[model samples]
Target chain A: MAEISFPLPDLGEGLIEATVLDWLVSPGDQVERNQPLVELETSKSALELPSPQAGKVIRIHGAPGETINVGEPLVVFEVPDNTAGIVGTVPKDDAPKRRVRLSAVLDED
Target chain B: MSESTTALLEAGARDEQSVKLSMQQALNRALDEILSTDPKTVVFGEDCGQLGGVFRITDGLQAKHGESRVFDTPLAESGILGMSVGLAMAGFHPIPEVQFDGFAYPAINQIVCQIARMNYRSRGTLPMPITLRVPSFGGIRAPEHHGESLEALFAHVPGLKVVSPSDPHDAYHLLKYAASRPDPVIFMEPKSRYWQKGDVDTSDAGPLTGARIVRPGRHLTLVAWGAMVARCLQVAELAAEDGIDVEVLDLRWLKPIDAEALATSVGKTRRAVVVHEAPLTSGLGAEVAQLITQSCFDTLKAPVERVTGFDVPYPSGDLEDEYIPNIDRILLGIQRVLEYRRG
Candidate 1:
């Protein structure tokens, strides 16, 4: 399982920080994508921070009434899928060398 | 797109509510609208519900539409298509998706014999209004059997209508049109172009079926579909550097190809080049060349040419660079057609 951290997104207008109003999801709760993870109060209004991805909630960075800076970790999620396996590969270092001269094709004319 | 996929419009209306979306998102929205509008329509395929497909084209659709409408099926491609045939027979519009272009092979019998000929065999009684969504073509460097261009195989079928959208707008519109058709449509979704973002006007659509002349030019016509349309557009740009005007045509429907569009663009330019990912031997390019020849032979400046994949089996991702026709190869084909002279 991979632990992914969701950073607090800048909710427009060059906002710097937001106070955590309430935690809608607990640390052990499994959440769906776009689910309400936490409700935070911004300078202008209070809004719910939705989970960016669906995963098991591993940890919460801020408690209620705490201020978390923009771009700071909001919550950590443990993703279940392990996709490391045999798939397509682009070997950047071993890119196939290719060269074509139009002279050879044009010679037919 | 540094060069956007432009549909050669005839007299289509444009909408004010255009969203910059990827082809996948456009398709998802189209499916959502299809499910919402048509209560008889059903969408099901392997891993399409929970995992939201390997490409995530069906993401959040299952939760939104519920299990009965947008559900997952068994891993069997044949079974999925067979079930689609049965569902269509029961007066339902079945929009079944095969994970990849290569995966459609297992369901060929059900697709060709049953789905293609159902209406004809029943004398227009039982119509198979099935839109088989296949993630097609190779550019993502996918492994063997993960990327295959099966357009020719499907297009050769008598009753099947094959379509591959070059951009998100067309992807959104053509899919909804295909789902609404009474006949079966092999909707080839260019897997590589899924993430290519473009402006999708969800309001109104242009022509339902026909090749779109994305770039209008006076010199020559570059005909292509699916992933190759974008590549041909890129090549057209490169060809422009050499002062060669190239008209890029997106052949939307492969079965009943826009012969008039081919005739119009090629008749105007008098030179044509067909590009495709399928193998050169008996590929759809051959048919396209013949069509251009038949239509624009009298006014043609040069013979029709084809730039395509090698005759060998579609290889794994490692050899894709060498297998699939690159921009240079297409440019070479264009050059060949440009320099052709009758001996």
Candidate 2:
């Protein structure tokens, strides 16, 4: 199993920090991807942040009413080693498909 | 190159006590070092305080430097830069962040009028010792304006120095060096390359300004900046197999460009291709091409070729691959320069 630390994502554009409103799930609870993880109150509005992956919660950071900065640790989860538990760009896993001699890629004209 | 620049290049070559660091980590470390060393230094932007920046380039900075020195500001880009001007005037080396390259648009009034001209306007009595950090360029499929390339816009200004780092070592040292400069420096961080990991020497004071030859080839030269530097290096490697020896030059500084380096490189190879993510016309590539033409005109083999984005608004994620100059486009550019026939 691998443990993943999920940071508090940018709740809104131009928002740097958010107040912890409530935790829907406690540590040790198994959660599914996109499940309601916690409620955060930013300057823009209050909303529930969803889980980025399916895993068992290992740790939860900040108490209700406590504030957490964007990118700060929000939750820790335990999952299979092969599973990725965060959001962002997808990894390039396959061998580049366009491998050819430089001559082949260039045009004669 | 001067003695210090050569020393930095050599130190990078030596790779002493190097540690693998992503551009994000490297920039963070550089900011940490700057904040700790300079008592007057301050870092702030929207979400940069406790949030550590939208991309987390300033991650954990507020905790380490404390809220007073490293804190967040309102979403107002103008306010952020206007405060930087005030902070610099008050003897503080204000290191303000614009959050993203696109966000800088709103701050142009402050950036161009105040930060870029305070030195000249004040007759150098009060120089804006500020480093405006903007996570620049595109590849992560961001929305419109989020991935804009404004090097030409910033470079056009008189009193500002512009730079972008292609790797971790340069990112680490260049950020620290920019903060140390007496003049305001627009430090453009390639957004897509932030997650890239490479060996960075924390002590390496990378070139304050000037281009460095990352790869040397005898047949032709591929000149690029920011994310395009890495792409050029890759093209050079692939070209090597096709019997085309391509030299890769990273133009670290956009303003006060190292004309000497351009002359030296194109002078030897006599063939050059400049690539950038910005649009074709009025891009920084045009200036570089002019510089090469002016300096190495007599010895040129063919006109300097430019493989750049279309002359349109920089597209968002879905059209990024189409907009950004790809390996195929660059290879064709190389072929054009390498197989040029004098008419």
lDDT of each: 0.84, 0.86
Candidate 1 lDDT over A19-103, as tens digits, reads: 9999999989999989988999999999988887788998998888999999788888786433211234222222222243232
Question: Residue by residue across B138-208, what tens digits does model 2's lDDT show?
Answer: 78777777788999999999898999999988999888888999999999998878877888876556555
DockQ of candidate 1 (2 decimals): 0.11
- Residues B127-202, candidate 1: write the lDDT tens digits: 9999999988887788778779998999899999999998999999999999999999999998878776799887
The C-alpha stretches of model 1 lying farther than 4 A from their native spots are A1-109, B1-15
Question: CA lDDT of A86 in candidate 2?
Answer: 25
Relative to the unseen true structure, what is the C-alpha lDDT of residue B53 in candidate 1, on a scale of 0 to 100? 72
Candidate 2's DockQ is 0.18
Candidate 2 Cα misplacement greater than 4 A, ranges: A1-33, A38-58, A61-109, B1-16
Give me the candidate number with maximum TM-score. 2
